[model samples]
Target: MRFQIDPNDRKPLGRTGETVPAIGIGTWRINNYSMAETALIRAIEVGMNLIDTAEMYANGEAEKLVGRVCRIIGRDRVFIVTKILPDRFSDQSKVIKALEASLRRLGTSYVDLVLIHWPRPGISIEKQIQFLEATVEAGMARFIGVSNFGVENLSRAIRATKKHEIVANQVKYSVLDKQVEKDLLGFSIENKILIQAYTPLEWGGVAKNETVISIAKKYGKTPIQVALNYLISRPMVMAIPKTERVERVEEFRGSMGWRLGAEDIEILEKI
Candidate 1:
C-alpha cells in the first residue's frame, strides 16, 4: 500500500530540533530477520521514519537487519534508535565498547539516539549518564535517553547529565497500560522530554477490546489503527508498533493523518 505523508504529521524529538513521524516501526522478536527487512523497508516507503531496535533484540540480529534496510533505503531518510543492555552500563569502558560494537553491527558511525535499555540495580545512574555524555562527545551518538525508566530514575538521569538533556523516555504505554500516565507522562511534558511509547497496541490486547472495536468501526479504521492513533494523538508522544509482516506495516501507516475526537478519546480512556 502506498501512503502519502503530511508534513504536519511529525512531532518534536525532545530538544533535538528534529521532527519524526508520529507512528514509527518497532523491531523486537522479529525472529524472521529476512522478513523484517522487507517490512521495515516498506514501512519507510510508507513514510514511517522512526525505526526502533535494541542490541538485546534477537541477539543483535535485529540491528543487523535494520542496518541493511537503512542502507538500502538511504540512512538519511529515517531516524535510527537503539538501546544498550543495562548490565553493560555498570562500567564506563563496557558502555563505550558496547556502543562501538553496536555501531559496527549497525554498519553506521553514529546512531541518531541511544538509550539505556533499563536501569541496572546497584549501579550509579550518574556514572552511566556520564558515559552517555562521553558517547555524544565522541560522536558515537547524536542524542541519548533511557527506556523503561520510572520517574525517580528519569529525574536522576537528568540531574546526572550535565552536558546533555535526556531527549526521550521509551516505555510501554497503551490505552490499557497507563502506568506512565500516573506521573511519568506529566513529568516528561514538564521537562520537555518526548515519550516514545512501545507496545501501544498492548501486545494485541486492544484488537480484542469491544470498546476499541466499536471506536474503530465508528472511525472506519481498524482497532490497531485506533490504538496507535490514540497514543500519538497527544503532544510529545510517539508510537512504535512492531510487526514483521509487510501487510501489517502498511496497516500501521494508516494510524497517521487523522485523530480521535475528544468524546472518542474519553470513551477509550475509560476502557
Candidate 2:
C-alpha cells in the first residue's frame, strides 16, 4: 500500500509543532534486547516514523535499543515517545531525574512526548501537572500527557494544567476494549487531545477473529491491517502497533493508505 503523511487532522502533540504519523510503531513487546537495535533499524527502513516506548519497558533496555537505532539514522526522522511512572510525581526532581535517565539511556537530548504512565491513587493531581510543566520548562520533553486516564481524570488533568497544554492521552485502545468510547474518546477529540492507541492489534486476539479475517480477505489485506485502518479512520486517533519482523512492520504500514468503506467501517465497529 502507499505510504505518506495522512491528510487527517495533524494536531500538535503540544505546542512543539512536531506532527506525527497517524499510525505509529510501538516497541513494547519486541523484547529481544540483543536484537532490539536491528528491529528498530528494520522499522525505520520500512517507513515507521513514530516509535513509542516507556522508561519501565524492559527496565529501559527498549530505550537504549531505540537510542542506538536513532543515532545511526539521525533523530530527526523518528518521533520518539515514552512515559514517566506516576509514583515519581510527588517529587518533581524525580520527574527530572527519571527523564535524565531516560535521555541517557536513549542517548537523546529530547523526547517528542512524555506521558504520565498512569494516574496513581493517592498522589495529588496538582503535583503531577506541576512536574509535567516543570519538565517542559526544563526541556526534558516537548509535549506532556497521561496514559490510562479516565474521563474524570483527564478532565481533572486538563483543569489542573490549564496553564500548560495537555496534548494527548495514551491509553489501552483496541477493538476489544472501547472503554474510551464511553466518553474519554469523544471528550478528547473535542478538547484537541489526540487519542494514541497502545495495543491496536487486540493483543494478538484480532488475528484469530473470523470477522476481521473475512474483512481482510475482502480487502486483500491482513487482519492487522483492517484493525489498524479502522482505528486510523477516526478523527484525532493514532494507532501504535508493535511488531519485530520487517514484513509485519510493512503490514502495519500497509494499513495507512486505503480508506475503509462506510459499510466496512460499520462492520468493524461491532468488533
Candidate 3:
C-alpha cells in the first residue's frame, strides 16, 4: 500500500548509462496464457518494462504470448530480452536464424537484449560470444550478453568481444543462492556489467522462510517483496522474478524505492 513509485523509476543498466526498472518480470514456465498476459500488461504499466523470454521457454509459446502483450501494450513501451539456444552457436548463420525466429515470434525486428541460453560443451566461449556479437551487428538485438556464465567464462567472453561490450550477465541470483557473490558479482561490478538476478524469490521457496517473512513485517511488505528488494538493493543488480498474478506485480512495486538496514542485509546474507 505504501512505497509506491512513478512508472519511470529506473536503475543503471550496466555502464552503458542506460537505465531499466529495478524490478522486471520473467516469463519462464508460464502456462495460463490469458492470466500471464494480463499480469505482463500490469508489469509494464507499473514500470517493470523489461520482459525476459526465450525461444526455448514453453517451446516458444512464451514469446508468442509476449508478442501479444506487446501488441496490446505497444512494443516501444516494453524492453524485451530474449535468448538463443547454445546449439545455435555452432554456426554464425544458425545464430542469426535463431534470433530471427525469436524476433518473428516476438513480433519485433530487434530485441532490447539477447543472450545465449547457456554455454555449450566443446564449443569455445570465444565462438559463443562471437555469435551473440553478431546479433547486435545484424540489428537483431540492441545489446548482447550471456546467461549462466561464471567469472572465468564471463571474463573470457568479454575478452572475445570485438565490436560491442557485454553489458549484462543473466544468472540465477537470489538470497537463497549466494553463489553469484563469490566472484561473478565482483567481476560484474568491476567491469560495469548488469547482473540480471533471475529466480530472485528462489522459485517461491522464500514464501515461508521465517527470516524473510520477519523482515517483510518490518517493512509492511510481503515475503516476496522482501526477497526481491534484497536483490535489487545491491549494486548493478536487478531481479527478474516470474509471476502470473496481477496482484503479485502490484506487490513487486513495494520492493523498489526502499531497502533493508545493514543489520538486516547481514542477517539475510547468512540465510
Could you say which candidate leads in lDDT? 3
Q: Scored by CA lDDT, what does every candidate get?
A: 0.86, 0.79, 0.87
- Model 1: which ten-residue window has the lowest total lDDT? 1-10
lDDT of model 3 at residue 65?
92
Model 2 has an lDDT value of 0.79
| Of 2 and 3, the candidate ranking higher by lDDT | 3
TM-score of each: 0.95, 0.92, 0.95
Return the lDDT, model 3, position 107: 94
Q: What is the lDDT of residue 167 in candidate 3?
A: 87
lDDT of 1 at 158: 91
Stretches off by above 4 angstroms in model 1 are 1-8
Q: 41-103 in candidate 1: lDDT tens per residue?
A: 998888897899999998888888888997899988778999999999778889899989888
lDDT of 2 by residue, 1-271 (tens): 1122234634346444556677777878675655656666777776667789999988898888789888898898778889888878768889899999999998989998888999978888877887888888988787788898888888888888845688888888876666767787778767878889888887778878898899899999988888888777776688888876666777787887777777777776676
Evaluated at residue 247, the lDDT of candidate 3 is 90
Deviation of model 3 at 38, angstroms: 0.6
